[model samples]
Target: MYPLLEVHLDIIGENASKVLRLCEGKGIDVVGVTKGCSAFPEVAFVLLEAGIKILGDSRLDNIKKLRRAGVACPLMLLRIPMLSEIRELVELADMALVSEISVVKAINEEARRLGKFFKVILMIDMGDLREGIWPINLLSYLDSIRSLNYVELLGIGANFGCFGGVLPTPESVSMLINYASLAREYTLSDIPIVSVGGTVALQLLEEEK
Candidate 1:
């Protein structure tokens, strides 16, 4: 048996449902993030059974594990795409949060090799100073991505708690929405995922009416 995470299952369920409700009719979807020891396939399977439409994690291995266990759902990789694991990332992930067109190029090439469409969320730094495209440079980056092979430009995302100071708020969310909207001026609508990062946003998500 594995070690327990001591996560309150009821809190998880309640949190998941609460987050989903916040996204409902907002023209966005909450991919219930399962990385906080809750990333295991069994726990994620429970969330899926409860009607969560998406599962998110930082490790491609977890996605691979879940797929191997037949716990298939719409899996999203929340980690930065490494230069090395492009092949496996392409094979296992339905989507990812990324920072560069080079990484996007790699994902697109791998998707082409596998003959599949890959969804991707461009991670914007958004004053967070973390693993994402610099906010000032993001529009150009999005424009650059428009020519890539099989990337479905999902939306923009940002890490709030990752780099020490930034926290998720209505302001941050609005900033991200605006940043993503700039891209929309160049492209079309239906940009799929706007991955607001970490548990704080998830908490605010749970706190929504």
Candidate 2:
């Protein structure tokens, strides 16, 4: 007999609904991350049906797949984009998480060439030690990003538990919010989004209950 894996999408949808409801109450919108499932359209559909308006993935290929499948909701690139893939990333992703000024510049240049605007979420390193700019260097990056003509600073985000095994705490969350405030002040624009949650954060919430 061949090995088989069964995916119970009904249960997944129910859980997604619960999380969506909780986030909605707190004025938070959830971005359903599909990298774990390779951005399978079926699972992505379940998340959308459960009220996830934006879909996020770590791979540009997965984003392309979702687009090919006709999932028109806003797609987010969860990983820091590579400079070489800037052109395709600009076309496939509605928004992307970025930490480096060079990559942002590349994206901006490509967006200019394509005659399209691109959105970016600056990533701050809030004790995660993962893919993000150091808190001390944020202002410099913000200054550079603000001067860009084609790329819009959508907001900020921080990774937790993905690397360095740092657990998400209230203090960490507060730090991210503080950085978001600083970004808004420095950019002189209302940086609307502050993405600071992940599976570990969700598990923390579950443990609190």
Candidate 3:
């Protein structure tokens, strides 16, 4: 009885367990970015039941569906925030992966209106010529956030599969990791989330031993 599309819960369970164990006592949390199969809430439901604390997707529809399905887990949006969709995004997303200062400010304004503090991960471009700020431009964004008080700067993240395929290189990830460490050293972020999420790198990250 295989459905036309399905997510393998066993692999997900194992992957989740691995991340949890690998980051044990390392002050890291794993959120399944279910946008890969979020059109089907059942996929997210399975991951949720397995104890994934956060569920992330890029679609508003999927976010609403998961919420409507009674998912109690925190929801994070991975798409670029649209000013027009600010209210609904804020209503549905507990957190957002953001790359621009304007969007960050917009979320802050929306959150303030709603009397809420939204969590966010500031995305570093890291050679991903996509949505994030260039390295030279990132410092200003960081400095800008420090002056703002409505949104919580959760950490940092990078996407590796979009816009010129600029995010998938080791050099790119290494640069980001190094920068995050430097920022942490300067007390900007003590524990940055240098996320490497995508199927392309999965094989490399898999247990080859």
Candidate 4:
């Protein structure tokens, strides 16, 4: 016999579905962040069943746990990856939010060695001062990474309401969108995912800006 915390699985599932519906109605896809729940497999499954196409977790171990539990959604590392974990990150996550070019280069090298294609969302620090390339240097950074074969430039993203408590406003998000446009112009390709950070932005989704 073992001790376990009691949980209302049905309610959990209902809440997951409700949130996903709300976000989807507003033209946003939910990542179903699982780190807060310690990446519990059952809870993760509830989110998956509720139509979460992407799973976001801060820790590599949690990502590995999701895969071990047979969750099929593409996993995203919400934090900038460490060089030491590049091999596992490449093997596990479908995409990662990144800031430093050096780390991306390492990911590319590891992916090449493993014969795998890795995806990255270049994070920009839009006054939040967290993990992102400075806006001024972004285009130059894009140029440097364009020739990388095994690494796919997924899109650009930013973190707000994080360390700096910077609220993600219409203006801030617009700035991120503008950066995405610049990225597209530089690469001459459609930037696939311009991820707007945090649950706070959900409140503003209805506005047609």
Candidate 5:
């Protein structure tokens, strides 16, 4: 047991609260991302107690773990899901980030089978080239998925600094905001979660401009 890891739950809770308060005053809602910590239950619980509205993880198994521990906030799948795991994704996550039309269709079918309507954020690739549809293809792709009754289009988002190392700037985030507007225009409704970030996007918030 010499290599055993140690965690201070109370300290984590305090730190999370301070960060959440800072983000909150600036009108930002924080999602406690548990992937880096491998979704440790104690740490995740501390984040929950610190008031994150959503718990986000890249793996379905991690989200499942959080749910089994009775974490009550809405759970979000940070990574785009695979077609094979649509059923699990539907069962476990309240919302997911998605790009491919085929995967979206699978999720729709799975949601219909499960008698649940799942929420989704369409990811736009603003040069990071990781997991989003290209901006030019966004509107048309939205049109294709607009009729998906079992899937509620929650909002739009983008990923940067993950693969391509493209840093998020005010200009790039503005582009994401514009895409969200375009999505609303197509649907003629208010988009709920314009999630335009990952961990790196935090830099945008910390900046005074």
Candidate 6:
């Protein structure tokens, strides 16, 4: 027999609920990431039942699975999108993490062609050396995005403890907050969400820093 991996759905649901409660108390919304489970509908349903209003996955195929399974909540594409996949991405995902202006333009074009509006989280690289653009270029990206009709700048996000092993510190978290503030000032939009990547960020909340 192949090595079997077992999941206790009850335990997972309990944990997710606990985390959701914690985050909600802190005025934070959690995006239940389904990538770890390959976006399996069973697990996705568990998360949804536990009050996860949004689901995130790195693969478009996974998003498709959730959609086909009748998961109706907003779906977020966690990975920076490929230009070639922009059309389907615009069709499938409600929001995405984007770093490159070219990909954003492609998404805008597709959304316009389909007569659909798309949402995106502009990613900033706060020394994580990951998928986000550097902070200095933020204004330029915002400028370009502001001109797009179909693409809406949903918020700003940053990755940590991934490629560069940069752990999330209070300073780093504050920097992300500052960027969100700057973006709002420049775009004159609310820019409500400020997302932080990596499970390690949970520590900051725990420490209440």
Listed in order, each prediction's TM-score against the native is 0.86, 0.95, 0.82, 0.93, 0.95, 0.97
What is the alpha-carbon lDDT for the whole of candidate 2? 0.89
**Model 6 lDDT-worst window of ten:** 198-207
Error of 1 at 205 (Å): 4.7
Better of 3 and 5 by lDDT: 5
Clash number for model 6? 0
Over 1-209, each residue of candidate 2 has an lDDT whose tens digit, in order, gives 99998888999899899998777767778999999889889999999999899999999999999999989999999889888888899888888999999999999999999899999999988776888988899999998999999999999999888788888787888888999998888778999999885767776455552
Top TM-score model: 6
Candidate 2, poorest ten consecutive residues by summed lDDT: 200-209
Residue 172 in candidate 6 has what lDDT?
86
- Model 3 ranges off by over 4 Å: 1-28, 166-170, 185-191, 207-209
**Which is the leading candidate under lDDT?**
6
**Candidate 1 regions with alpha-carbon error over 4 angstroms:** 1-11, 22-28, 202-209
Off by over 4 Å in 4: 1-4, 206-209
Which clashing pairs does model 6 show?
Answer: none
lDDT of model 1 at position 127: 68
Q: Model 4: per-residue lDDT, tens digit, 10-117?
A: 898898888787777767777889898878999899888877888899999999998999987899999999999999999988899888889989999999999999
Error of 2 at 50 (Å): 1.1
Better of 3 and 6 by TM-score: 6
Considering summed lDDT, which 10 consecutive residues are worst modelled in model 5? 200-209
List model 3 lDDT by residue over 1-209, tens digit each.
76685567788777777766554435546677766775467777667666668888888888898889888788988767788888999888898888878888998999899988988877776555676766776667778876777888777677776776753556666777776776566545565477655554454344321
- Mind giving the per-residue lDDT tens digits that candidate 1 earns over 35-142? 776466667876876678888888877788778888767788887788798899888878888887788899988899899999988888766687888788977887
| Residue 24, candidate 2: C-alpha displacement in angstroms | 1.1
